[model samples]
Target: MPGATSPLPDLSRPDVGAALFSTWSVGTPERQRATVDALAASWNGRSWPTPELLSQNVYVGTDGDTLMHHSQWTSEEAYLTFVRAHRQARVDEIDAAVPGIERNGIANYRRYRGFDTRTEGDPRVPGCIVAIKADFDDPDPDLRRKWIDLVIEALETDPAPSPGLISADFHLIVSGARHLANNRVEVLNYAQWTSEEAYDAAIAADDPTPEWERVRHFPGFKGTTAKRYRFERSFVRP
Candidate 1:
C-alpha cells in the first residue's frame, strides 16, 4: 500500500527514524495563536533534522480544556536531540508570551518505529499536511465556506504546487468517531507531497494575498492546540 505522505524508505539503510507525538492545550484563543506563532518562528532558522506531520483540533466543549495540537516527528533520537536542545527554552518562551498555557498534557514523550506503519519504512523527508477541524457555531456555515475558498486561493497563489505535493485531497471527514464529526464541522486540509522541501516551498511562497487574513480573525479559531502520537502499530492493506 502507498505511504501517508511520501513513499516508504528502504529498510536496508540505518535505523528507521522515529515518530513523536505531543498533545497539549493552550488556555485561551489569544494564547493559542501566540503559541503557534512562537513555535513557527522557532522552527524557521533551525536545520530541522527530520520531517514533521502537523494537525490541530479545537473542541467546543468546556470539560477540561478546549484547544489541542498534534505533531509528528521523524525519529526518536532526532526528536530527543531537538527536545534536549530546544524544548525547555521554547516552553519558557511560550509561557512568557502566552500566560494562559498551563503545561504540556503529556510529559513523557513516546516514539513509534517506522516499520510498523509501512511495507518498507516511512519516508525520510516526508511532505507535511496540516489540518484544522472545528465544529459548527451560529455563524460558522457562511464563514466556513468563505474559509475554504480562501484556502484554495492561498494554495493556488503558489507557483510550484508539485514536488512534495503528490496530491492534496481536501476531505470533509463526513462521518467518523473523530473529534470534528459532531455537527456541521469542517476539516480544512488534506494534502500529500514528495518531500518536506517541496511542501515548505509551496507554502512559503511570494504571495501578498489577504485570503488567510480574514479566517485568522474568525470567531471559530479558539486556539491552535495539538497532539503527538507514536506509531506503536498500524493496520495496512495487502
Candidate 2:
C-alpha cells in the first residue's frame, strides 16, 4: 500500500488478488462497538500466522446495527486454507465477547474497475464509505461488464463533478457454487466519500439527472441496495 498512514484499504492494490466481504448484525450501537473492540483485541493478541492474509479492515454501519469486514488475501486458495485451519478459533473468540451476533455468509470478489475523483491539491480524507450492491438476472460475465461500462460512461459524461465523491471501486463476484445456486451475478461498488453530509447532499440532488437515467433503467438489473459506514479500524499484516 502506498499510503501506509491511511487506514483505508487500497482497493486497487496489485498484490491483493482476492477479497472477502462479510457482515455481522449485532442488534445495537453498544454491541457494534463491542464487536469491533473484540475483533481488534483478537487480531492484535496473536502474531499473525497467515502471511497471505494481507489486511482486514472493519467498518461499522451508520445504521447502528451492523459491522462490515473487508479482508484482502493473496489468493482465494489461501483464504480457503485459512478458513479450514483457523477460522473457527477466531470466530469463537469474537463470539465470546459479543454473543448472539448474526453472521452473514461471506462473498468473494475481484476488483474489476475503479474511479478516482479526488482533487489534486485537496488534503481531505474520506470519512464515509458507501457500499452499493447490484444483482443481475443472469450469471454471464459479459452482462456484468456491460453494466459497469454504462456506469463509467454515465460518470464520465456528467457535466460537473459529484460533490463529496472521492472514489468508487467496483467488484464482480467470483463465479462459484454459491453464485450458481442463487442464479444471479452480483456487483459491489465500494465507494468513498468526504463525509456523510456530502453523500446525503448528492442523493438529495440526484433525481432526474440525465446521465444517471440510463443506468437506472438499464435492463437485466434485478435490484440494488446501499449502506453507509464509518471506518473503525484496520489491521495490516506485518
lDDT scores in order: 0.40, 0.84
Name the best candidate (by TM-score).
Answer: 2
Candidate no. 1 TM-score: 0.32
Q: Which ten residues in a row have the lowest lDDT in candidate 2?
A: 176-185
Q: Which residue pairs come into collision in candidate 2?
A: none
Tell me each candidate's TM-score: 0.32, 0.93
Scored by lDDT, the top model is 2
In model 2, which regions exceed 4 Å deviation? 1-6, 178-184, 207-209
Give the per-residue lDDT digits (tens) of candidate 1, residues 118-230.
22554543334333344445344455555555556655664544445543333232233322213335443423345446655755774544655655565664433222111
Against the true structure, candidate 2 reaches a TM-score of 0.93
